[model samples]
Target: MAILSALRLTRAPGAAFVVMGLYWGVFAAHVPVFRDRLGVDDALFGTLLLGSSLGLLSTMWLAPKFDQGLGRAALPTAAALLALAWIAPSLAVAPMAFALGMVGVGMASGLLDVVMNARVSQIEARSGRSLMNANHGLFSLAYGLAALASGVTREAGLPMIAVFGGVGLLALGLMPLLSRAPAPAVAPEEGGAVRLPLWPVMLCGIVVMIAFLSEATVESWSALHIERTLGGGAAQGALGPALLGVTMTLGRFGGQGLAERLSETAVIRVAALVSATGAAIAATAPGPMVAYLGFAVTGLGISVIGPMGLALAGRMVAPHQRSQAIARVAVIAFCAFLIAPVLMGGLSEAFGLRAAFGAVAVLLLMILPPVLALRRRAAAPLAVPA
Candidate 1:
């Protein structure tokens, strides 16, 4: 009931989240197929994924300007671009071409991500309700469904074009739902530099960054881990990421109500420990069933961490500064996505995928110190300008 109500409040931005999930979910499930077609090892493939850093750069420099210029149209426009951009990699057989295609996908995804998250923060401020968890929960649901569907498609021996085309068209169909009322204008940076609580923002960003890093590592590699490492079939391999998505859906939705009742810092602390244990289990799992169990546990615990971190960042700033603060956090958080594929690849190449996953467990545990710092800072009263 609480999640349903939060979804009602955030339906517009939630549509963008859903669209983003559909693309990435399908892509993640198809990673094995894509890699085989390119005929490159994990290391080279990881290097190719570095192309997304270009998109990260664009998001850092242009997303704010793009958001300001397009206002209400930004979300739909970015959605359409993503739908179109995803077509490139689906068709590319060569490594270089595929890398370039990822650039388009990454840029479009980052722009949409920043705009939608900012919009949600705005809605949270206006409605005085916790909505990010529910919105992100919808993303997980869409991602899980798409991964399951893509797995079936792969088992059917369908071409990448077919799977990607279906997802692209689905994204285009959802564009109208993303349209919404214009946001209230924010002061231009030149108007005056509002003194930001930089330390708190950085702390929250680190939390979000770690959460996404774990997510990206799992999404990009879990399928391969199940198939090659545990001898799972295509459908079984897809279940790895699918289970993560499904459990995350539950966690995020549950976290919606929990956020209102619990201390966000305490929630982060507990979630990190829970997720680390799950990752450790997955790292040492002997079979597909056990790996699924691990992924499920990891998903449930990690789901709320990123949303809680973003919510913390928003609360630490004033209304006019909300967008800027969230954007900063997002920029930092997105570094995880940029680094995850390459880092996981390098780690998997050097050690086995199991060890790579074990490293993720360690990374999850490392976020505690930052959470401690954020807890102290969050205790301080904010100095909002009139």
Candidate 2:
């Protein structure tokens, strides 16, 4: 019920999340095709994918400005732009063109991601509700559905353009839902940028970054792992991400209540361990069914980490700096998207997807140190310099 209430309260931002989920879901399910189209190996495909980070990195400063300048329209505007930008990758036939297309995708995705998360923080502060998990749950739900559908279409031999273009149209149609103005909150200063807390933000950002890297691992490579490594068909490969989406939805929706009962750090600590175990299982799995079980476990554990990190960062800052703090953490964490393609690509190319996933298991453990640091500072007053 709280999840439903939170989703209702943050409908506009939730819609933005859903749109992102749909686009990414479709993209994730179709990675093999995209790579095949360019006729490149995993290593080069990963490098080319890194180009999107250039676009994402550029938004670190621009996102805060967009929040201040556009006010309520910021999230929807970014979503609309993303609708147009996501179509480019389907059109790209060469490695160079694909790389450039990813830049466009990254730019649009970065802008929307920052604005929507910041908006959710703004609403949470005003409504005094734990909304992040619920909103993210909505995204996961949409992502699963989209991935399932994309798999069906791919198996039917549908054109990439038709699939991506249809997703864009769906995103465009959701613009009205995402267009609502924000709940009243302290607006950032119009003329100058506010300084965000460096150390605390970085600590939380790293946790989020690791979580996202693990997430990107599955999103970008899980299908290939299932189909190639486990000898699954196209539909079975799609189920890899689809299962993650489903479990994440359950985990995040459940997290709304879990956050109320437990400390955010505690939840994240246990979550990290759980997710690590799941990744390990996935890495060692010999069959698609075993892999599915591993992925399901990973999704449930990882679902709450990023949301909790952002929620913690928001709590640590002043109201006016919430957007900036979210933006900064997002900038740092989103670098995982950049790192994932190359890291996972190289690992899978050399050692295989199993080793690459094993590395994800190791990476999940890295969240524990930051969890300890955040707990130590939990009682400290907000002490960041202006």
Candidate 3:
């Protein structure tokens, strides 16, 4: 009954995840149109995209203050910002306009990411159920569907304005649902405000970094690997990301069930090994079909590691500190996003994509020791204020 209730309660945060995915999906599919409209070259457009990352980093640093001030209101506020920002690119007439718009979108996305995850942690603590995997799964599913829909609309000659407008409207419609959901009550520190421990938090951050690095490698490079390395055409290359996305969605859903039946550490250990093996297979595959299979296996293996790491971090501190802890870990983990493209690009330029991916496989295996450390510490009591 408790689990059922928790499942029902996930609707609010899950909806936020879906909206986020929808915006990103539409943005990715319409990038060419946006670049053409702004009259920018590939290098210039790439530089503009960096504006989003800057905005993300700035807002993420400020998210804890928003949480402290707004409490339950913070979630919807960020969602509203995202909705408003979603339409910026559609309305841009020049390069500067588009860059400025991306900054807004990035800021809003960063805030939403932290707040929504923190909300899920609060719910999990209160309901005594695992919700992260299900919530994240919903995100991946929405992203896949939205990307497909955007592609179809583009093929049918729809404008970027209409596509982004529709996505913004969908986000607006979800705001009320998110805003009305009450924030879970956190237990007050018995003595005073309790500081979160450092080492465990750093460990969690490291685990998440590795997870994102592996995921980014598969997502960003799989298509190139398929087309260039495996001698496949565009359609076949497209299947690489599609296969990873589908398997990731399925794996996350499965992870939700697995969390109920096994310890978090056990799940992480198994997931790491599976991901490593998949990466190895993908790196060495001679054909697109076999590479697709490898990507699918890798997707399944990595799908749950981020959510599990976040859950473990949340559990390590007092409820009131969950947001801050999550933010700290998130900030560090997100650096992987900034670092990965450059790292993979450099490696691919020098050693080729297959070799780059092979290095990624080795990095995936490095997650196992951290999982073991978490398991060893699971039996120890957290030093909460009393």
C-alpha lDDT score of every prediction, in listed order: 0.87, 0.87, 0.77
State the lDDT of candidate 2 residue by residue for 262-363, as single tens digits: 988999999999999999999999999999999999999999999889878877888777767776787789889889999999998999999999999999
Q: Model 3, 1-386: lDDT tens per residue?
A: 53345547888887788888777756655555665688765446556666677788788778767766787888888888888887776789888888798888889999898788778867776777777777788777776666557656766788878887888788878888888655735545676555777877888898989998888667656766776788975446556665666777888888877877988788888999999999999999989888988888998999988888887887778777876687788888887766665667668767887888898899989998877887777768877755
Query: Against the hidden reference, what TM-scores do the models get?
Result: 0.94, 0.92, 0.81
How do all the candidates rank in terms of TM-score, highest first?
1, 2, 3
Candidate 1 regions exceeding 4 Å error are 180-191, 317-321, 381-386
Please write out the lDDT profile of model 1 over residues 1-386, one tens digit for every residue.
77788888888899899998888889889889888999998888888887776675577678778888988888898889888888898899999999999999889887888788778877987998767788889999999989988899989999889888887787777777888734636744487667777888898889999999999888888999999899999999988899999999999989977887998899999999999999999999999999999999999889999988887887778877876787788778888977887888898889989999999999999989999988887798877854
Answer with 2 or 3, whichever has the higher TM-score: 2
Could you tell which candidate, 2 or 3, scores higher by lDDT?
A: 2
Residue pairs whose backbone atoms clash in candidate 1? none
Q: RMSD in Å for candidate 2, one decimal?
A: 2.4
Worst 10 residues of 1 by lDDT: 180-189
